[model samples]
Target chain A: MSEHGTTLNIEKFGSASEAKALSAEADDWTLIIRPQTGWFDLHLADLWRYRDLVTMFVRRDFVSFYKQTVLGPLWFVLQPLLTTLTFTIIFGNLAKISTDGLPKILFYMSGITAWNYFGECLTKTSDTFNANASIFGKVYFPRLSVPISIVISNLIKFAIQFGLFLVFYFYFLFRGSNIQPNSMLLMLPVLLLLMAGLGLGSGIIVSSLTTRYRDLRFLVQFGTQLLMYSTPVIFPLSSIPEQYRWIMIANPMTPLIETFRYAFLGTGTVSWGMLGYSAVATLVIMTVGILLFNRVEKTFMDTV
Target chain B: MSETVIQVRDLSKRYRLGVIGGRRLVDDINSSMARLLGRQDPLAKVDLLPGADKQKAARSDEMWALQNVSFDVEKGAVIGIIGRNGAGKSTLLKILSRVTAPTTGEVRVKGRIASLLEVGTGFHPELTGRENVFLNGAIYGMTKAEIRDRFDEIVEFSGFEKYIDTPVKRYSSGMWVRLAFAVAAHLDPEILIVDEVLAVGDAAFQERCLGKMEKVAGDGRTVLLVSHNMSTIQQICKECIMLKNGSIHKVGAPGSVVSEYLSETRVATNVDLTQWQDRTGNGFAKLSRMAFLNADGEEAGIFPIGTTICFDLETTYNRELIDPLFEVIIHDPAGEPLMHLRSEHDGLRIGKVNGRTSVRARVDNVGLYPGRYFVSARIAAGGRNVDFPRLCGSFQVTPSPGRHGDLRLNPKWGKYHLDSTWTRGDQ
Candidate 1:
């Protein structure tokens, strides 16, 4: 057999002194696996090395979502359009909640577009462990890649919905509505980044917790809904009473939605202070989420 | 000079027994709070608590899947890990692959390591074969550029070029396994950790996988293989490690280590088979005991060649069985079936059996080669298997004088001996 020929070559390595000499240089080892690592050891370089896996996961999520479906990516536009219509009818027209002087459809559509991105990212990433127990159980990659890919893939959906919002946005501007667009529109990318960060941060926290406490899986479904009301998604932040403003601002998602409307429709209140606070909150939450996620990932296979 | 690519030191992994989520969340919160406050864990056993009982706590909720196992593997060494069920074979592979973490100790590894704990680890059914190849490749730690460069070769190796664009869900099970194994086969890591993945697909594909592994080993890359199939272990591994009950039982050349493992697995005569949990079937009937008997109807551990060997199986049925068929399959030392003796094949089907029954299959003038052999017993009725206990018992076959009066029968000739008359034939 061919194996015997190879076996002969292997047997020649009988020099113990050489192996011992080489092993003395322990620093030459590339990877050291242990039971526990420091809490802050995020292994970001490993994550960077596995960036292609993130991209592949993103492509899988994006391509597989629309396969064999009649509408395909049109659903990306339709989803927010339908949700905006429902909000405009139920809240704007029927309930008579003020839209801060902007057109009811544009106001609701803008809020729905931004909220949908955060909502999708949050809900999808929150279930990363449960949804991927099969793959995670068998293979080892940076577990954060799954949640990071979710945030990115949802960005594509958010972009499509943002384009649809822009259609009506320009139509209203050409119609000479009182609405005004201003330089705050430059904060668009930063606003998306803040939203993505908050969603990813909070989502991973819930996912890490649900590895043991599965009740959070059920809580996340309604938790995102409750969080939406606290944020200025359907109503303008100005509608809140002065005493309750801090509560709304404390939601972290508030300034993102407020800045989105203020930038595009030039209606909702936008403050640099609140936006900075939102960004800091995102950073803090992201740090804690990553640390907790890193800690849980090592032994979640046992508990999960 | 050889360099150690993988050095594992005092590795141990502990798993909590019982339902994973059975612990109350209150207990978890308490433990975390205690840990944060620099206090002893409230739920910790008394034995672990200072000033508590010196006696060991009844920590029945904990199990050590692996315990203080240490070994080193040189560069380019093909190492095989063999063990029975619950022997920590998969646990070791999982730790090496980083799929799970150990409870203690450490493993230091050099070079790029890719582990194929199972084939098709992250295959998305909605994705086409081509997309899955890239996805599965990335999951195995390959870059998109690397997969792109080897995409044609991967598809060619899988022999699924025509179906590359077709969604993997539409492919048959064999095709899917082929594509998955194809991507795995192309992973050119410096150290490859494989766990029983060669048992997939058909024989030809398995041969291809073994060939690929041999080539990988020949490339001066290290490989760690975990498999239950002894022949595959003996054929591929230069060195073998046998684990028993989460500890290393033996480490040596494949031949001696494998024989030691086989000899240890040879159950004593009249072993209580009912306690064998690693069995498969509907459980309508169970084999309670199995004994190897000589021609004198006495329990025997050794049977000389060309003698009557009887396999006595004691079974208990839950209900009355109709037309039950019993089978005794003799396997060689390498765990490959050497002979299959089925009741139906011999036209000795029993009409009916009640509660407890003793079945016997006797063969006259057995011609098996002189070696250790394992017996797998099975009971079937009503067109389905009632019980199948694999490798449940074993016995020794010693060489004896053949019809031609040869004292020594060389096992290298074959697994069995045949009495043939040789005459001068007109050519």
Candidate 2:
């Protein structure tokens, strides 16, 4: 058994050295709570220990979202399908926007498939604090579990949407429509990681800010919609004016969508340098987001 | 040699008062700019400005929820934290549970800590009982394998095995509370922090919860509990901490600490109700003052058993009121209503009342046990509440020799005493 000796030191005051000396014998203490922790106090070990909670949250979200609905998980496939059809009609046919000689339906479906995952992760994770405030107020769990679970749960929906895209891609291929499947298609996992990273990174940053300034919630709602226009989701990046192409390239999501289309449809822009830049940007945002989120999680209970 | 399972040193938590969103972004920017320029905060409180005469800012916007509270919990000890509302009991528990960080000082804890600030912290209404059990268990930091091992025991304990597959939203509110409490009861952490979760469910369930808690305490885990129920605290806790105005007022054996707390609360009851802000009603009429009177109409604060007691309420109204029902409810120290006295129930009819009227309800024999009881008064007219004030005032009941002769009445028997006659029947 560990030592059970009682130590009383109520008279000691304003002595940082004594406190440090006590804390330095840290192997005996399972946890030491203080007023302010460093920015990098991410508590990754605690997060790992609470990984089951993250899985449970993901399960609850997936099961409860489609509980009574007749369509159920079918909505996951239908959502992207309907969105792709609408984009095909408005942006491709009516607006006279070129799909770079690829089939409009397949081109839009490919981009939508990739964009939907990032969009869902960003929008849902951004509301992590507000949506789970009641549970957060009552219990002490890794607050990051909620957003991380959201990203994972949305992956299931992404899979369903990706399967739908594959069905259409094969149908066009067997019909002799001009589409190429190439080695670049192996970048699918890396591209997915980049999207998840960018989404989670910016999502938590906004979630942390929203705890104090509620006005940011409204901004996030429309901000995602405005952001999709900058990416190559509805339109091809190659069609933009040469001088003005940098505007679209500035968005981290731009290269991700462009590369996803080029890999599958073999018609959109894909550059190693741009993809590398997007990867670097994701890393930076993720680091900043996690740090800000850690800082806010400790004290947001009071403000939120 | 008892181990100190938890040590809290100079722990304090400061909360900013007023609306959390009261300050605009412009004010935040201006303050940051001023701070960056090595000047005082531009938007700080007037007293906190550069030229303030006070040694400390003492900003009115700030309030310390917990101030310099230090204590240690030995393993196998059940410690009860008792205080009035806003006395910082919850804040102390919150800090210890890590729901929020303290503003200063530190707390070092050994072993795993599971805090049940509420019974069903993460119970989703749409999930089935069985699913929620696993979910709630995981939320309490239990793994899936651990939950699976004890899932049967949990289901049987909740007495919801038949309804285990049904969604929680479909269950009755009582069933939901039972299921939630069952999950909480099975948490076997080294340190258990509970905050008034025993107040939920029915009386029998509360008893079962207390029994479970006793078993937990008996298992030699460190338990920290916050509750207003003095009896439970005194019965379960070997030691008690009394909090007053965000600081520890006393810490000792449960019996003495509870009595001290009760005595202090007795003195804190307000006699004048006009300025009491904690009230709810439509506000057509208001209760101003309350006085306890004896049989001879003499003002008194204490009355012995079997004696006539009257509660006189001084009331005021802005306009004439008709057929107003005057009601008074007596509650025990735990805020549980023991008796209700209503004019309508007694068939008393008051035709009309104007501004500044007094109402009195007289009891022929005050059969209450000897202890302090609070009064909640309400005046209703035309199917609507004119005024309602809860715990407006308190009075004491003293023990007296009744038909039982020299045996004093024990409050543990119950809150009321009934007149009875015993006789031998011829066979």
DockQ, per model, reads 0.39, 0.38
| lDDT tens per residue, model 2, A1-304 | 0011112225222244655565566459899999979998999899998999999999999999899678999999888889988998898889979889999999999989999999999999999999998888889988999999999999999998999999999999999999888888999999999999999999999998888777788789799999998898888998999999999999999999999988888888889999999999999999999999999999888875
| Clash pairs for candidate 1 | none
lDDT winner among the candidates? 1
Q: What is the lDDT of residue B60 in candidate 2?
A: 59
Contacts from the true interface found in each model, as a fraction, amount to 0.54, 0.49
Considering the two chains of model 2, state its CAPRI-style docking category. acceptable
Q: A1-304, model 1: which lDDT tens digit per residue? A: 0111111111213466776777676678898999978897788999999999999999999999999578999999998888888999999889999999999999989998999999999999999988998788788999999999999999999989999999999999999998889999999999999999999999999898888877778889899999999998999999999999999999999999999999888888888999999999999999999998898888888875
Candidate 1 local lDDT, B232-327, one digit each (tens) = 787789999888767777788999998888777654767789888768999889999989889999988788989989989899999899989999
First chain TM-score for all predictions: 0.93, 0.92
lDDT of 2 by residue, B108-129 (tens): 8999998999987789888999
Give the worst 10-residue stretch by lDDT in candidate 2 chain A. A1-10
- Cα lDDT computed for each candidate against the true fold: 0.86, 0.85
Which DockQ value does candidate 2 get?
0.38
